[model samples]
Target: MTETESKARVAKFHIGQVVKHRIFPFRGVIFDIDPVFNNTEEWWLSIPAEVRPRKDQPFYHLYAENAETEYVAYVSEQNLLADTSPEPIRHPQVREMFVRIEGGAYRPRDLRVN
Candidate 1:
């Protein structure tokens, strides 16, 4: 396998799963998934090399919130784990994209990527 192919991993989470950053203290619901890194190079370069994720792994687009702010986060699969908090997420945009939070997952509304 090519180096990138050999390193690629199947995404462990899915759209609508709640997850937390493995290193950071933010939590969010997955709204989108990229099979491989697809963000701008400038964004990639902004992360310190020592902590940057490899491009071959799955990347998630999340509706994320922290104590101080709410925003979307593009995170690597290696940097996320399932969120176990009983509290619900409060990111404002989640209601626009999901039908409801049921059980431990968010139910997505009809998705359009235009």
Candidate 2:
């Protein structure tokens, strides 16, 4: 297999993986995976958008969730774990539901009452 195919793609992680952001309390699905840039030895996960930084500069070394800043932590292959088992402790920010209320094309609800 080509290096790009292997390294550029995010490594697979099962759902309910008990992954903690090396530097943030935000942890969720391995929902997506993308291999590290040019570096086959690393991997990037599809973490929550709130936990993620801007796209211009992607990827960060894993650090303790309590880490004060990015400089203090280091993420490597060793830091990554593959465990699909669920966590007993629920995350604080877990949204209970995503109610998708579609808005019709600028039609005001008041019009129906008239």
Top model by lDDT, which number?
1
Question: What is residue 63's positional error in candidate 2, in angstroms?
Answer: 14
lDDT by residue (tens digit), candidate 2, 12-55: 33322334544434333222232443233322345354553322
Clashing pairs in 1: none
How many steric overlaps does candidate 2 have? 6
Model 1 CA deviation exceeding 4 Å by range: 1-7, 110-114
After superposing candidate 2 on the true structure, give the runs of residues whose Cα lies further than 4 Å from its correct spot: 1-3, 6-12, 20-29, 38-77, 83-89, 95-114
Write down the worst ten-residue block by lDDT for model 1. 96-105
Per-model TM-score, in order, reads 0.87, 0.29
RMSD of each: 2.9, 13.3
lDDT tens digits by residue: candidate 1, 3-108: 7767778889999999999999999999999988989999999999999998999999999999999999999999999998878889988888886565767888
